[model samples]
Target: MEDYLEKIYELMHEKGYARVSDIASSLDVQPSSVTKMLQKLDENHYVTYEKYRGILLTARGQRLGKLMKERHHMLEEFLRMLGVSEETIHKDVEGIEHHVSPHTLQCLQALVLFFDDHPESLNDLHAYTEQFEMGSPTDTEGKSV
Candidate 1:
């Protein structure tokens, strides 16, 4: 439901409004499924949903959607810094976003801040990783190549 709300918010931001079909398309789900979820969100006071019409996020929905989007962005940034492939970053962010704790998110945010403030350190780590990856294989005990 957080994912749905986030997508709805994003669509609304991009297009000034979000219809069930639009949300469904963005989420890659059937419109009927979107309808059902929207109805539930409406009942929960997260959104104002109307049949054959657009959706609007409530204040609570807005807050949650913003947080969800931020969390996704943070995870993606962290993964990119680690040299994760785009496909893996996308998949891993989706898998981990919902389950990540607030404390962990804070830690990641701090790590991002640190890296941003210390580009030289980040560059050194990247260089070391590149060299490590290019080096020969290690033994079973991980002693030598």
Candidate 2:
């Protein structure tokens, strides 16, 4: 499953090899579930699963996993820029990354790049957000009252 692939990718990044127990713990699932998913992944050629040994991703699997991780990071960064909290970013990104299209992701990447080159814009945006949070009323035409 996609969750398995994501966990394997994360574990591989954190630690070299991904043990079944590690994967189970990361996903908060039982080892039996991890074993079953590993078997399926092995059959699909995404990973090499031994009975007791750890799993290793194949070249194709690794590439796909890396891409997913990158997209997750991009989503997190984009959400942070929108004033989403760090705690919320992890949950929000996890939920949206799989559903967002490549075109949307590209747009988000472009926005990130644009802000990176123009940090002042972020400050202005933050000030505007603060104005709304401070209970400043806006007129019908959308101008601050």
Candidate 3:
């Protein structure tokens, strides 16, 4: 449902409208599925749905969708700033945005903005991670310290 809201909000801005087919294609689902979800969203007061007409989000729906999109965009930018591979970044962001709390997301957004402003700090972090990539030094008994 969040995914549908996010995509619809995105398409609304990008294309000035969203259709069941467009959402189905974007989500890789069938139009029938999109229709069902849209009805649910409508019932929940998140969207105004009328068959063969257009869908428009209510205030609450718009807020939630905008938040979802921002969270997704922020995670992607944060992962990219950390030098994450493009292939790995998208999946990671999707997995993360759904699970992370609003507070944690804010923290991550702060970190991303900080790194963007102070790229030298990000370079330092990359340099620091190199040690872990090679292998963490273990203490006695083969335990990592």
Clashing pairs in 3: none
lDDT comparison, 2 vs 3, better candidate: 3
Candidate 3 lDDT over residue span 6-70, tens digit each: 99999999998999999999999999999999999999999999989989989989999999899
Expressed as tens digits, the lDDT of each residue in 1-145 for candidate 2 is 8778878988898988899888898889999999999999999998988997678999877977888888877888888988999888889987898787889899999998888889999887787778788899576587878
Q: What TM-score does each of the candidates earn?
A: 0.87, 0.85, 0.88
Candidate 2 wrongly placed segments (more than 4 Å)? 135-145
Clash pairs (backbone) in predicted model 1: none
Give the best candidate by TM-score.
Answer: 3
Candidate order, TM-score descending: 3, 1, 2
lDDT-based ranking, best first?
3, 1, 2
RMSD of 2: 2.6
lDDT of 1 by residue, 18-101 (tens): 887788888899999999999999999999988876788999999888888888898999999889999899899998888888
How much is 68 displaced in model 1, in angstroms? Answer: 0.9
